[model samples]
Target: MTTKKYSRLKNSFICFIATTLLILNGCKTNPPNAPDDTTDLGKVFISANVLGAVIWLNGNDTGKITPDTIEAKTGMHEISLTKDLYYKSTENVEIIKDTTIDLHVTMEEILDIGKVYVTSNISGATIFLDDEDTGKLTPDTIATNSGVHQIRLQRPFYQDLSKEVTIIRDSLITLNFDLVEESLQTTVLLEDFANVSCNPCVASNQIIESLTKYTYGPEKLVAIKYPTNFPSPNDPFYLANSEDCDARMLYYNISFAPTTIVDGILYPISTDSVSVKSAIDQRLQKNPQFRIHVSDNIIGSTYFTTVTIKVENGSGINFSDLVLHTVLTETDIEFATPPGSNGETKFFDVMRVMMPSNAGESLDGISQIEEEVFNRQTEISTSWVTNKLHTIAFIQNVVTSEIYQAGSTIE
Candidate 1:
């Protein structure tokens, strides 16, 4: 009786132990939903703009890291940051346990530099400096100070841009600007180009919309809609400007519209960031040299601004047909489908020509000649959110239609 009882007892005890182990193993697999006690409480900073950004740590939102640091747990946490037009970046970060880590980063740019300088293809753009109120373009030397500066250019019909150009101490940068009318910096222009009613164009437009939104997002990026002489009749923006498109095409040697010159300078090899960054890095390596002065004022509801396109040491220059057109635009105008237009239409810089169609009045004898003026009437007309107005002035080659110098003013 003693031996049998002992064996039964042992079997029962073994079974009980096995059940307990199974339960413990299950618990390990699905741990309690609480911050681990052994988790590191160190710091890992976020790299974001002063504007705003949403940061995530370990699949949990660690709140925003605006212009500064983020308090995060240490050692290998998942990090995600998001904003408009920027590519959402996710990374498994390696933070030292209980240590402060600096993760300074420049978020990917979805919008073109909201500020830029443009030169006309033909006309000589006038530059008005705030310090001077009215000054010459080629003192070749307009003095600027540290901090923010206002510069402006004006012309009739074309949208005008007044922008803040920042200057740093002892930063000698020179920018000789050329502006463009009918900006080709938007995705719409590419759609207009690649989606012509012909082989590969229609499909190309669809591809452009999806890809551009994916890459650039919205609000930060836009594609100019450039209709051309290729018989894309359905496109309302389409115009019989073969000479304009052709000359620009030759200068930049661009094969199509899906192509654009970012920051008024370089062209992205294939509209991808990695490809685009290569061009950006090359330019950024060199500090900004010349400062373009742009500013504006309200005159009896007809806002008037002065655009001063100056060059540092700009003397004895002869680039044929450098035309200037000031364009005043109201962005964010939503449209389902414009009458006599194709595709979902969203217009930016809808050309309200303050000047004649030729870009200027004097067709002849306008060369090396410095200043010009163009005016327009600005009254709220459902163009933008009431009181939310922006002016963008671009300079393009009338002969080539290539945009070179551009700047904008927003109020």
Candidate 2:
């Protein structure tokens, strides 16, 4: 063998080695259709029979509604679709890297119904379902479609209550609400027609005052003494407001002084404390159908009185021919000498004036769950003490002669 033959053989072996290295490098490079292992994400196309169903991925809201595409990490994921009035649907899916998967869900409609027993701490509350009045009261069962619903309870003189409840199919749910009552108290009115000149009025007035001030207090009873012209026509209280005094005296058909009227019922003329107390106790047992609030303030020489009347509940009582009477009275009147024939030196709750006449303002249309406000202003009389002035208001049925409620500014 020659030296030239050896050199050519060595060069051929080196060229073959270089060709093999180039082929190996080309095989190591990734192909265009192959997936890159570095990225751990996949695309999911979600759709539902109900187009607006919310999509949840791995128990987290994907912030996307159905019929949309979402990107998620490559792993086993739980997909759920939720829509109102539809049963929730869930499915488990496996996602491959750089792969796209399609998911479709069939939503089921909620056709089953359930019963809810509605009740409250106080009965007679009207039931409302989803803002619609069901025309049903508490302690009644209402059939409703299975779903999430808003329940509301409403009643007169109570704060309305509301709650969100989920009704399960073929199940019964019991809901009870604690109702809050508006602050209200029934007050009795005692109208006593008396004169300072009558000797019997002194004893009657003392008995009435003792009951109204101490025995019953202002919460239970209110008394107004209207000066009468019977025994003494020259009575100073009668002279102050003769028109109202005379009108009230004739309305009740009073024949003499010291006559008492409890509510609108005429009572026998008696100075006995036991008789007066018995009459008042009868009226106190009646529940209040209306709430009366009276307030007064003095501005300049004018006395302003405001009366607010609210119907607390529906008692099925006829409200027709109802009248609201507001009276201005002077209390704790003291004098150095008796003003009339009687030797009485002190008078309390003397009728000063009746606003808008004794006929009273008509409350013809007042009804349940309603409020009426009246503002009346009267000129302050120079003879009456300003600090001792008080206002009293009451609601009465003129036809039946029944007083429903009464209020005063005594406190």
Candidate 3:
């Protein structure tokens, strides 16, 4: 019986060892849950503005050229950029697990509306902003809200003009006009570039007055009479200012007497309406960066002058170099002419003299004034006035003598 019992125990122990081995083999055959293949993070693409420029990721300079791709972690990443004439910009981005990311940037500069031009047959015509007068119908570079605006035109003895204008993505807009004349406020500078014995000066004055009356009423046009070549004993209103006479011969390099300069340019009797309109209209298309608000104050002896300039900021252009000048005008002075100008008299809004010629400020520039936040200011003063004086101030190029803006005290 003892022998049988020992044999049974040994068999049982063997069975237990066999079962343990089987379980261990089964565990080795099937493993726990885990990923099968290796995963990868995404790449990042960096691109600066349209201008070809360098880009940096974090602090390291990626050898990759612009529009380059760099290795990145699958989560969040920070970026830095550097370029010429531009400020550094930083941005945070999230890179996807398998997809690449693209980024862009923006920049700033000086000068808003580089230039504005307006042209019409009636450039000398009055212009209105909203309901206020904006000097003559010249191409203006005015900085205004990016929206719709009302514009009106008017001239002496002619029909008035009114319209709506839009300022869009571009800073420049050319406003052209086609107009008809009803009345004329024509000023005939009847220059007799002839000898004292010349008799045609008489006929020229008559024609000039007729044109003035046809364009504008009598209150508008002025007739300045002068003799040229040989001095006439009857000379009254003649000054060397006229190119027709000996005094202005060297000044204007002209040797003719029956010549006239309309507005600020030389205009002969032969100029047709189309040519006239074309010439005047061309000036109206130019955009000016600065505007003028002339204020004349009576503070003691000196006339305090304030010229407020409103400049618009945008785009990539900047307008610099500012200079201010003022002119005085007096009209309705009667002068003896060859019969035709009798009682017709003469008038002049003469630019007598410039006030404190050094009022200079950069009208349209990339940066603001040193207070370092916004715009800047400039002004000058003069006490000398003859009561008939009206002031016009403008921003001009000191070397080129080209006026960018014109403002009248009356405006």
Candidate 4:
């Protein structure tokens, strides 16, 4: 072969190999209509109320969290925002090519707002919030908002209570209340031992008449006068019911005339107002252990009396051999003239009859709260005036000789 022919052939083969290498490299670099990034594709901008929320696009991970923009195709895509302590919010969004679509998501917390626990010492009390009935009783739970609120507790026969409390977020607020009991009225009894013939009885009687009309009226004091057979052989008032008069005189151990007893305690039988007022005041200061209520019905000569005794809060009290006495008495007994030599024309609060033979009913000592009711019907004698009659009930401690409480029918 010639030298010129060899050189030319070698150069041509080398040039062809170079051209093939250039074309292969160009094909591997990029294809036609292919882009370096998604510059022309649609974008999805996601914003959420909660931070650090994971974002998903078209059931695929976008590798981007919330408050970010994701490049997507021009079509409908499911966009989701999720977090550990928040509810997942999802929506389908349509993307427009070369444009951004904003997605605003509102996520809800996973926990409740607040809770409240209401309780009271006494069960079955109604609960109220902000003056609105909650329809919930005591020892119950309620779901409410987090803030300041007013709570009220109410029950029958107990004082109502209201209070203000603050509720914390994602926490429980407990409210406990102790109720108070209602107040009850107190009553007292006055026992006067006198004979119409006794002259000193006139002044003593006058003093008692004024006391019965005190500020408290009929509820303040109750008087029962028993006529005695002292200082006169045949006292008309005493002879009217000698059995009861003598029984009372012997029971009180009265050895003189015009003796006055206030709740089984002896008081001076004189016109001195200070001594009488002091004795009555001392009895009124004592707290009564029992409450007495009496009612009566009269039908011709038949008298019906009902006595109710309630042992209220006997927690620290002890009773031994207690007796209940129901006595029928007449008030303002007009004699037109002096019934006896006492010169008193009117006899007030005179003992007419004793129920249950005067021995009284055996009241069992109660160590707790309790009530006892007694009823008696007796035929009234024609000698006693029925229109002015009243029933008096009392509870007495036999061992201590102290009268605990007394009540009566004023009318």
Which one wins on TM-score?
2
lDDT of 2 at 205: 91
lDDT tens digits, residues 1-411, model 2? 132244335546543553354234332232211221244678889898889888877554555798998776688988888775566799999887898999999999878978799999988788998875566999898877788999999765577899999988899999989999767777999999898889999899999889989999887899899887656666777666666776686576555667788888747445888878988998999889888877676643467888888887756766668899999988999988898877999999988877866889988776566567899978765455677989989998888788889999896
Backbone Cα, N, C clashes tallied per candidate:
84, 0, 38, 0
lDDT (Cα atoms) of all candidates against the true structure: 0.42, 0.78, 0.43, 0.71
Each prediction's RMSD to truth: 28.0, 41.4, 43.3, 48.8
Candidate 3 ranges with C-alpha deviation above 4 Å: 1-277, 299-302, 313-322, 334-344, 357-387, 398-401
Query: How does model 1 fare in lDDT?
Result: 0.42
Candidates ranked by TM-score:
2, 4, 1, 3
370 Cα displacement, candidate 4 (Å): 3.4
Cα lDDT tens digits, model 3, 44-93, are: 77776645545545443443545667765567766666453344567788
> Who wins the lDDT comparison?
2
By summed lDDT, which 10 consecutive residues of candidate 3 come out lowest? 27-36
lDDT of 1 by residue, 1-411 (tens): 242244346556543553344334331221111111244456676776535766666544444544455554455677777554354567677877567776654667543223223334334445554432333332234444455666654433234445557755555545444444432222111212332443443343444445435654432233333333232333332232323333333343333334434434445543454544454344334332222233554322244556555333324323455555554434444556542323434444332223223243232343234533444434322222323344445555455444444455532
Any runs in candidate 4 off by more than 4 Å, and if so which?
1-182, 315-318, 365-367
Q: If scored against the real structure, what TM-score would every candidate get?
A: 0.35, 0.56, 0.32, 0.54
Candidate 1 vs 3: which has more lDDT: 3
- Clashing pairs in model 2? none
